[model samples]
Target: MPSANGDSTRNHLAVNPVFTAEPAHIPRNTLPGDGLAPDVAYQVVHDELMLDGNARLNLATFVTTWMEPTAEKLMAECFDKNMIDKDEYPRTATLEHRCTRMLGDLWHAPPADDVTGCSTTGSSEACMLAGLALKRRWQHARRAAGLPADRPNLVMGINVQVCWEKFANYFDVEPRLVPMQGERFHLDAEQAAAHCDENTIGVVAVLGSTFDGSYEPVADICAALDRLEAERGWNVPVHVDGASGAMVAPFCDPGLVWDFRLPRVASINTSGHKYGLVYPGVGWVVWRDAAALPEDLVFRVNYLGGDMPTFALNFSRPGAQVVAQYYTFLRLGFEGFRRVQQTCRDVATSLAERIGELGPFRLLTKGDELPVFVFALRDDVTGYSVFDVSAHLRESGWLVPAYTFPAHRTDLAVLRVVVRNGMTHDLADLFLDDLRLAVERLSRQAKPLRGAESASFAHGASAHHA
Candidate 1:
């Protein structure tokens, strides 16, 4: 009985609503609920508060936040490339050129015919591409040298990120691991050279190690490779994995020649998100020249004029991250990056000094190269261990991760602190206070198995079995 305007009509069917099966093809115009509702801004802001309220020391891994104004500008402007054009926006290409030039200058590379580089999702993909390039180049050189192609191998540290192992596994090459030991927490140049034979493709030198935030002696590694190549009559190259250190050393320690300046270092890869002060998911890799990246490794895609060569593993990532990185370069310049890095170093040193003074723990790495600190419980702590202290710290809301040292150093478990940009002095003090409280609380607790009989049984049973 209702008219078209009434609730009973098709346009006004709410009154006698029947939950029919969704029509075979519901018209776009006749949607029911608001397609997009529930704004997430408030929820996101709430989460930030929760994160801060909990232990805010955040030495777990390398994560960071930009300053308010800087973040606002990055989010607002660079995210939306309204002015960019597929035809004219050559901004992608332009940004690539700019970054390549800047990195070349930062790493001190001589001008050459084939200075090539690409932006990536992160250092992982960049590393993959570097590995592929090395593989291809080695194959090409092998054919020319009339050497057997079956025994291709890559030399690298045992403590290397799993990506290196995956690279070798995927390429069906031998991963000649150079073991790390006391005073040698990185690839030993002599040991790595010893693994090299006619089939050795390249040696990966880490500019910054993840475990202890130390630099592998790239100069010494390069020297070793130089000697090997001279004696073997085959070309061997060095790939610098400068993921975190590349960004730090340029500003804090400029005199280092670990990059392309070293004769044997043919390529370098870094995570822009790590130390470049950009958000996650941006990385870079640059070859000394076009020759370093074999031509076969590049593929021409139909999207960007099939004639243009593409080097990246990922195809359609948001251009926003790239623009943000370029913006960081323009806004911070060289001096700004240096100042920020210097501040990070100072803060790290200050925290290390404070931790040292507090007692019950000893510092691991001297905060000189990278702003990361590792510490272990003092030798005298009887019932408690570093792991126990790590658990206590977590109760206070800090997300510090505790793990055993790599390979041969499994006996030594240490806690690491990675000081990112956002952590302030006040936050550091709070973390220290919580750490002290954790130690004191742990010490006060009596051990469940304090008797000599209990101790004797545990060790005596093991000895009896042996």
Candidate 2:
């Protein structure tokens, strides 16, 4: 047996094993035969994480990067709790229900004693649930009408988040994605109604488009749908993919009629971790009423499982985000959320204005709607593309993204910036300074780098899908 002193020395984690002449190098592909000391293992992982970008300076993502210290503490405390274990943690479940009902009220669901909604891992999962519901409801209607539902299709803009595509592929529903027209980066009322028929299950309206952070005309889309139903007898519902704007418009643009006020809107989804002012990996979905979600109907896919049950974002996701969302609701109330979101809007618009004034770029959106904006290089400036500017900004610890428009507008490429809660006025000024210097340096460069290093970062709505 080894001596007691030897065992003690081996167990001591305070010792810096890396400082020794021969450093330890273990393959991470397989489980190690030996165990490491707790503190030593922690130090190794912590050091590796130093390579991550500063979240506050990250302009590419829409997820929340800053939270109150108290919120952080609460999230840390509940990290061990699983959302699926509702029976074991009754209080957490109750809080989740309360948050759901609160969102229902905020979205202006029809006044009722019982509201139907749920918390999700994020908007992706919530969107899946809502899409499933739409499909099932359409199936029921087709079956009742003595018609075949074999060719079920969903109408939506091509700019929708990737999750919708995944949902359609998985559920075997045909996706009727409306393509973008010239100068029309997103879907419009005419395009949405034109794609509908008897087989159309629902139409998706994006409250905020990630391409330009502009709101689609929800009321106009609804009116078109109403006319279609009156003319063709096809009563199609609308699903609002408000992953970012559902939390925004009710507070910032209360006059905007995009939510439940439009009876055609059957469901809506939002990321609580995005504009809702919480951390990542949390989202909310609310139905207009109990009839909107066909929860009682059995949906079975035998290859996966004989009798598969459906769920929202709460299956096995981190429960702490839900707790953190509850804390935000209680701590901020309605007015507090408005102030924080408004501040973000102010920063976004101010920064966009300053960037437009730089003379080398053209303004696409003012950030007045979603606290996000996109700008393209002026046609006369040919020395550098938006990709070069994006790559150069990455050097200064900023992460503005540059990408080309989809479909009909692929010829246009632009750089985008998202002004979140922590990006204050001072930081905006610093960003403006860096942008000016970048333009000047790249303007004088010999030739275009062809956006050499821009591929490393994610592109378009999928990056900010939250």
Candidate 3:
């Protein structure tokens, strides 16, 4: 009924409506009757995220916060692909296998050709897989020796991440956590050896501890286990939780003997998303040899149109992170990784030195081994605690976490900072400036800073479980 021009006008009117002065607010708990425009929907969600702490200023998390544009493109391209479907995405599977082999070689696996490993959703899943293998291997050995495998246990420091506890609870293994004492923040060889028996599945040695970022003595633990084997006939293997240090120690400190070079370390798990310089949701676990991971734990499935050997806790996950990991490996190589890690270490060391000079703070760990450090307020400093400083630092959008030490050391509350790849020296300087200001403000306060008591209590509770 309309002319050509009128029809064109009508089509334009339908396609592009005038902006509404009062846009409908999005429902918080229910769906809307109509969908919003793409840009409006994006704006609404984006605006909400502005309340979050900037990832760049968050020194609390060990996760990687930045990546190359090319890696981002690669990740975006493969987000829809499922990592478990090997037949559909053969290249991704090949990349995953290559990454495993590379990590195995990096860890100095004895039989390079026979090395076995896999990609996990994250370090937690990787840890779970590693724990399962140890449990299964222990059970098989017990059955072979005509012994009971009912009372399996895992030995680790109280400083271990919560994932270890989850692994123990979810898989029916008793956690024999070694209590932390004064000046001894991690599991020692003597402590590890004393906790082992025939029922012990394995000892978990953290290369980079989550509590204070110190590398536990991996070699010493292994030697103690060796001695235990000779004296009591109980051979306990070791699994290194190298979440932050696996990619670090190899690149920064090449001479470290914490990996496959050690006879007792049967397996290791590292976060690809952490020091490996990839985004979140990628982890790697590698065994010293194929025999280290029991065959019963691996299940052969033909569901995705071909036979695939799946050993991960997660059935389907985004293959994008694995691709990003491979991209990083190719892009960085050994020298590039070393340079980045060394830079971070330098920054951490410099910060630690400066913080120690502040008079009111004492250095716990000086970022000597890993690119992370912890500091606590000097006991003489009254009124303001480390928690007050942590709270005040948030005013400048910095997220520095303050928490107490585990078990016997609950009284030792401290602040921790993780210097990751993107943390430039300039940003470090800014953080130091802000930290000094925060300390000065807290020092001048008449009474204990607000929330100081609650923060102390909360950290004490957390450390009780640590």
On TM-score, the leading prediction is 3
Residue pairs with colliding backbones in model 1 are: 55-397, 55-398, 114-289, 114-290
- Candidate 1 error regions (>4 Å): 1-36, 40-56, 76-89, 301-307, 446-466
Among these predictions, the greatest lDDT belongs to: 3
Q: What TM-score would each prediction reach against the true structure?
A: 0.82, 0.91, 0.93
lDDT of 3 by residue, 322-400 (tens): 9999999999999999999999999999999999998899999999788999999888887788888888888899988
**Pairs of residues clashing in candidate 2:** none
Lowest lDDT sum, 10 consecutive residues, model 3, at 7-16
Error of 1 at 462 (Å): 30
* lDDT (C-alpha, whole model) for all candidates: 0.73, 0.85, 0.87
lDDT of model number 3 = 0.87
Q: Comparing candidate 2 with candidate 3, which one achieves the higher lDDT? A: 3
Please write out the lDDT profile of model 2 over residues 1-466, one tens digit for every residue: 3355432223322335664332255444456467766666677668767878888999988899999999999999999998766666668877998998999999999998877788888888889889988999999999999999999999988788888888898899998878778778788999999999999999999988877888888999999999999999999999999999998899999999999999999999999989988998899889999899996643333322233233553457668999999999999999998998899999999999999999999998999999999999988888888889988898999988888776667778888898888999999999999999999889897767876245455543443231
